[model samples]
Target: MRLSNRNNKPLFSFIYSLVGIIFILGVIAYVLEISKFDVFGKKAWILLAIPSLLFLLLYILGRPVFEYDSDGEALNFRNNHILYILARKDAKDEFPKYKLLKFNIINVFVFKRLYVYILSKKNHIVILKYDINYLSKKQIKDLKFSLNKVVKANKEIRHEHEDNTVAV
Candidate 1:
């Protein structure tokens, strides 16, 4: 199965553009005396500060475009800022299914992360993290279902192997 937020690009773009326009209009209104309100005359800084703060807040909390694929023997995941190069945080990873030991989902405030535990060739446990903030509730459920299947299969196989081995 494959999941992605690529189809929501237009909605994201519209929100960004709306915020930008609000900021520009606020600046113009303050400079051109378009409003007769006393706040604009005496506390003009409010106009500048409000929109600036809003843009910064949105940037910090903005969701990234996310993708997950579990089509073959490996699971693939990716995350890139919806605004593209404006934010340089992008991640991509692929790991085989057989090595997967377990997985976890962490949600705090507006942020979410998926932690995958895998067994390395050297018998060390490796932890992989992926951003899952952009995924919807249903998408997250689906992802959890997929990971659970793999982890369960891995555990059952290990148990079968253990049952076949005898103490020497």
Candidate 2:
């Protein structure tokens, strides 16, 4: 499966835009206050400009990006300058016989976490916790799909083996 980049959450984009607006307003307020001073007004403006510029830079560059391709056998995640590569084999090894039951975005404090639940054929359950920043929303969903498919295929193979043994 290939996921397109057009499916980003609109709410997050709105919030980021709001934060940029607030930073710009703060810069304007500081400049206006400094102009009231007779001397050293430029210094106050400079101080305000420094942080405002930094905030804008961070807001633009910190957005999450994701790429998922089942045929390629790996999921690629990029946030800012950090990159994470998760191979299909690695994920299969980790969960083994568990099937992905459900997943969602859960908020904790200042961060968003992804909570994934998996059910094993033996009735055992496994919960996987991942920070949302580690992967894009689309990548998360695609990974879940891939994992579930693998689990089901493995289970079918096991069932066929058991049936053959019983017939013999």
lDDT for each residue of candidate 1 in 1-168, tens digit (9 for 90 to 100): 888887887887887888889899879877765456554566777778888887886666545677888899998878777675456567787888889999999998877888889899999999877777768899999999988998999999988888888432
User: For each candidate, what is the lDDT?
Assistant: 0.81, 0.52
Best by TM-score: 1
Q: What is the number of backbone collisions in each predicted candidate, taken in the order shown?
A: 0, 0
Error (Å) of candidate 2 at residue 89 is: 24
TM-score of 2: 0.36
Which candidate's lDDT is highest? 1
Question: Where does candidate 1 have its weakest 10-residue lDDT segment?
Answer: 32-41
